[model samples]
Target: MSTYFISDIHGCYREFKILLKKSNFDVKKDYLWIAGDLVARGPNSLEVIRYLYSIKDRTNIVLGNHDLNLIAVYSGIKENKKENYFDDFLSSKDSDKLINWLRSQSILKINEQQKIIMIHAGISSQWDFETMKACALEIEASLLSNDYPLFLKSVFNNKINYWNSSLRKIDRLRYSVNAFTRMRYCYPNGKLNLICKKSPNVVKYPLLPWFIISNKFKEKYSVVFGHWSTLKDTRVPSAFFPLDKGCCWGGQLLMLRWEDKQYFYQSYLG
Candidate 1:
């Protein structure tokens, strides 16, 4: 069975399905890895969630920032923005079920056998695979816990750049969520910038892309991520694979076949 990776779909249901068709993805035989942002922005967010849930057993997903935002909004911790276009998704009868499934997804996915790691955004340089996994697991656990709404409330709008073992439990969880789903740039010393969303070439000073600062990890394993659409076509090492091509912004949906490292694309249909 072939494995394919795609990310930052952002509810572009038509484009997503087109990409799958373009790549000849066999639902019964092939596996799919999604780097998240499964909803928001584009039209048909509800349909995207329904389809993904139906094939969940054959899919691997890491929660993205928009996914987390949807969860928080559903839980009444955050206000839903109209620009996210989540009205139908939130109003659906299956909204609760879909949101629960989303909450159950981890922030990071690792295939040790293949030496591949997938996250929504960039990995923290301070975190080795073990540390990253531990942090991700913690966030997963929190989301699954009875106090998940409280957990989401604690993490909302909170940003933690540096990792400290002595941090409070809530703080640690917040850091993990942000690092896995929203991070973009990092300071020279490995602290996350979390602000500048511009392309690396346009950004200077002490800030560098998180992948650049965490090159050591990339050298050991292929790091696949999406959150940064502005990262389009920025050449990096072979170990780094960025799949988000701004499909929600009228670009194209991109997918990578792991076996041959082949890239597939489907232009935005919306």
Candidate 2:
């Protein structure tokens, strides 16, 4: 059986399905790893979530920022934004079930056998792989806990840009969530630059792509991430793979066959 990695579905269900067909993905045999953002921006958030839920056994997912926001909106912690186009999804009868499933999903996944790490956004330059994994699990625990609504309500803080082990539990969780779902750029000293969403080339120095900064993790793993569609053609090291092709914004959807690293693209028609 083969494995595939893709990200930032953004409710582009048509393109998502077409890309899978184009890649010859076999649900029974091939495993699909989704870096997340299963909803928002496209016309079929409901369809996208339903299909993923149907095939969840064959798929592995990590929650993206949009996905987390969807959960927050559903829990009444945040309002549903019109631009996100989540009405159909939120109004669905299965919305509660879907959101619960999403909450149970983790923020990070590691395949030790393949030496691959799958996350929605970039990793923190200040955290080693083990620390990253630990922080991710901590967030996952919070998400799945009974107090998840409270967690969602407090998780969006951007004030804590730097990672500190001694920070309060909530602060640490928020930082880890941002690092895993919203991060793009980092200051020279390893602080998160969460406000900037532009591509790396256009941004001046001291605000480099998170991957460009050094971390304590040994150079043995490849990080497969999504969430920064603006990264577009920005070339990163071979160890870092970005799969967001901006499909919901009139761009194409991309899928990478993990076995051979072959990429498949499906241009958006809607």
Candidate 3:
């Protein structure tokens, strides 16, 4: 069985299906790993969720920032902004079921046997795999708890841009989520530069992509990540694989077959 990894689909269900067909993906024999941003900014967010849910057993997903935002909006913790692209999903009869399933997904997926890790964004240099997994579980627990809506309400309000084990509960969870999902650039000291969405070449001094800052971890394992569309290409300094080819922004939907490291693409149909 082959494992295929894709990221930043952003609700382009048509292109997603096209790529699957092009790759000759077998639902029963192949496994699909999504790096995240499964829904948002495209025309068919609802359809994407439903389709993935139907194939849930064969799919592994890490929650992206957009996925978290969808949860917050669904739970009434955040406003549903115009560009968010979740109206159909929110209005659907299966909204609660879909959101619940989404909430159950982790922010980090580690395959120890393959020595590969998948996340929506990059992990911090400060964390080894075990430590990162522990932090991810902390946030996942909150997401799965009875007070998840409260957790969502509090998660986005904090400015704890750095990691500290002594941080309060909410702060710790927020920091973990940011590092696993929203982070792109960070200072050499590992403080996240959450505002700079530009490519690494254009960013000013003292800021580097999280992978560049976390060289040690990069050397140890292959990492699959998305969420930074401006990355422009998939190559980085280490075994880091970037899959967000900006499909939501008129680029191509990309997939990497993990066994042989083959890359496949299906361009935007618009």
Candidate 4:
């Protein structure tokens, strides 16, 4: 069976459905890898969540920023902003289950058999595969635990630049979440740049996209990531695959078929 990687649904139930049907998704056969953003910004957050839950057994997911925010809103740690979608989700009968399931997702997944590593956002250049797996597990466990609300509120803030081995647990939790879910650009020395969300050329510093930064692990590793939908889809061979295509901005939702090469499908959010 073929394997596919899809990213940045952003609550577009229509697009999601279109992609699923058009791809001939077979729950028993083809594997579906979701690069996350399972909710927010579209008109069908609740429906999308419901649908995914119905087929949850067949899908493997990594949490995206919007998905994490949805989890926070559902858990009462963060209130839903008016601009943000998901009122229907907040008012749903199964809101509690939905929140738990969302939080249960991981920030990265690697399939050794397929030679694929999927992350919601880029990983730090400083981290190798083993380090990434370790850090991802630590963050995932924290998200799935009872202390997640505290993790979301105090420690989830991204302003912290200093990380120490002796830092408090909450601080470590926050750092892990940011590093896994929110990383985009990173300085040459690996400091995360959270403010600049534009494309790479817009930046003037030596800082660059996290995967582009030279590191001990560079040139020998493969990375597949989403987020920064501005990068859209690049023709950068398989060294780096960016699967987010701005579906939330009325652009197309993208899916990469990641076996022989990168076959793909798209659904316009218009």
lDDT tens digits, residue span 1-270, model 1: 999999988999988898899999999999999998998989888999999999999999999999988888998888989888889988899998898888889888889889999999978888766787799999999999989999988885446778888988888887888889889988888887777899877888788888877446766788899999998858777888988889899998999999999999998986
In the range 1-270, model 3's lDDT, one tens digit per residue, is: 999999999999999999999888899999999999999888899999999999999999999999999999999988998787888999999999999999999889988888899999989877766778899999899999999999988888437789887888788888888899899988999898788888876778798888887456666688999998899753587588999989989999999999989889999886
Candidates' C-alpha lDDT: 0.88, 0.90, 0.89, 0.76
Candidate 4 residue pairs in clash (backbone atoms < 3 Å): none
Instruction: Sort all candidates by TM-score, best to worst.
Output: 2, 1, 3, 4
Which candidate has the top score in TM-score? 2
Taking all chains together, each candidate's TM-score versus the true structure is 0.97, 0.98, 0.97, 0.91
- For candidate 4, lDDT tens digit of each residue in 1-270? 877778888888898888877777777788788887888887788898788888788788999888888877877888889757878889988989988888888788877665667888867665666766777888788788888877777756777543455757677666666777788878878878777787765566776777767654335656677787777533344477788888878788877766666555665656
Q: Measured by C-alpha RMSD in angstroms, how accurate is candidate 3?
A: 1.2
lDDT of 3: 0.89
lDDT of 1: 0.88
Q: Give the per-residue lDDT of model 2 (tens digit) for 135-225.
A: 9989999999999999989889889899988998999998998899999999999999889999887999988999888864438888899
The true-versus-predicted C-alpha distance at residue 184 of model 4, in Å, is 1.2
Name the better of 2 and 4 by TM-score: 2
Model 2: CA > 4 A from native: 216-218
